[model samples]
Target: MVLIGICKYSGGGMQLTKNPNSTDGLLDISYIKDLTLLTILNNIQSLFNGKITSHKLISTYKTSTLKINVLDNNKSYIQADGELIGSGDFLVSILPKAINFIIP
Candidate 1:
């Protein structure tokens, strides 16, 4: 299976999430202005042993729209924030500054 992680933050390449205490300025939202794509190739051994030797970094995309086309005949599961949203073809779009976060 292929695990693809498309995120707003470029957490220092493969780091994904950034460290709060780090002074690398990775916490800045400048990078979040766009999207970063990472594709990881997973196998049975990699899934069970927690090894990502075959993981591949796809590339960083400047566009806000993403289209995912599943070639499989079977239903493909699509998830967001750990919740299954839908299946099959997915059109992901990013709405910049669309939400107001009231951080306490």
Candidate 2:
């Protein structure tokens, strides 16, 4: 499934909570903002090292939106839509299951 929004843990690297909207389950993506853009690029690249062919980033104006583009080995792509609300400190609220399909 496509996990959207920011998942926050109580301690260190804990399982993601089901209710990301809750006050306690929020994480800030801005913390990593200080990292170089190249580092971020490499980090994202590592996510689909070999399992997928390519990926496309989607742009959205909505603060509560999580847009994802799924790509396959055939060089085709598909888009998945979801909502994510920022709860301050870079935390966002995303749906539990928003995966659409892999493009091919």
Candidate 3:
């Protein structure tokens, strides 16, 4: 799993997934903890350069399923597919090709 943002509860977040093409049947997780502004910028830059997995602050992983236990009093925001969906805990499981793209 890979994480890029903060979880708030744990102070980390998920940036990318298992596969960009959604064909891998696993979730690529990226998480970074205790990142400074410079490190954040560097992470973004490295992601663009396809070197995100090499950063010291970044942790990457691959899994078919995930379970997260969230704190009751904490409020954490999750951004999925460029939209702010909701807050709090997450239990993410990847289903291969469960979605399709529609463009005009």
Candidate 4:
């Protein structure tokens, strides 16, 4: 599974999203300053060991916009915020502070 996260909780309580050194929030305006991309391999052994083999592809990248292309012929479903959006290639970008948040 591939996951792009802005801050903690992006993975819904998954240990992969937890960072003790950083503050937990949706955006962590100060803590997590960049978007993180996590790419997981299909190998069960490597995943359990939490190790990165040099032979494998780069697993992470930091960027504002992410472009995904499905090279495989099989149809792949895409989901956003727990909702199924569609299938196929997609580009996702983050607009910094696009919406203002108010606390009561």
TM-scores, one per candidate: 0.42, 0.20, 0.64, 0.51
Q: Give the winner by lDDT: 3 or 4.
A: 3
Candidate models: Cα lDDT each: 0.40, 0.32, 0.55, 0.47
* Model 4 collision count: 0
The lDDT leader among the candidates is 3
Q: Write the per-residue lDDT of candidate 1 for residues 21-85, one digit (tens) a residue.
A: 22222221112222233322333343233232323422222335556688983857776565777
Q: Which lDDT tens digits does candidate 2 get at residues 1-104?
A: 23333433322333222333333333222112133566546655434342111223321122344433434424322222322432212224434345443334
* Model 2: worst 10 consecutive residues (lDDT sum): 51-60
> By descending TM-score, how would the candidates be arranged?
3, 4, 1, 2
Q: For model 3, how does the per-residue alpha-carbon lDDT over 53-82 read when each residue is reduced to its tens digit?
A: 567766766677877665662556666655
lDDT of 1: 0.40
Candidate 4 has which clashing residue pairs, if any?
none
- Model 1 Cα shift for residue 11 (angstroms): 15
Q: Which stretches of candidate 4 lie over 4 Å from their true place?
A: 15-58, 73-75, 101-104
Clashes of 3: 14
Question: Which stretches of candidate 3 lie above 4 Å from their native place?
Answer: 1-21, 72-75, 97-104
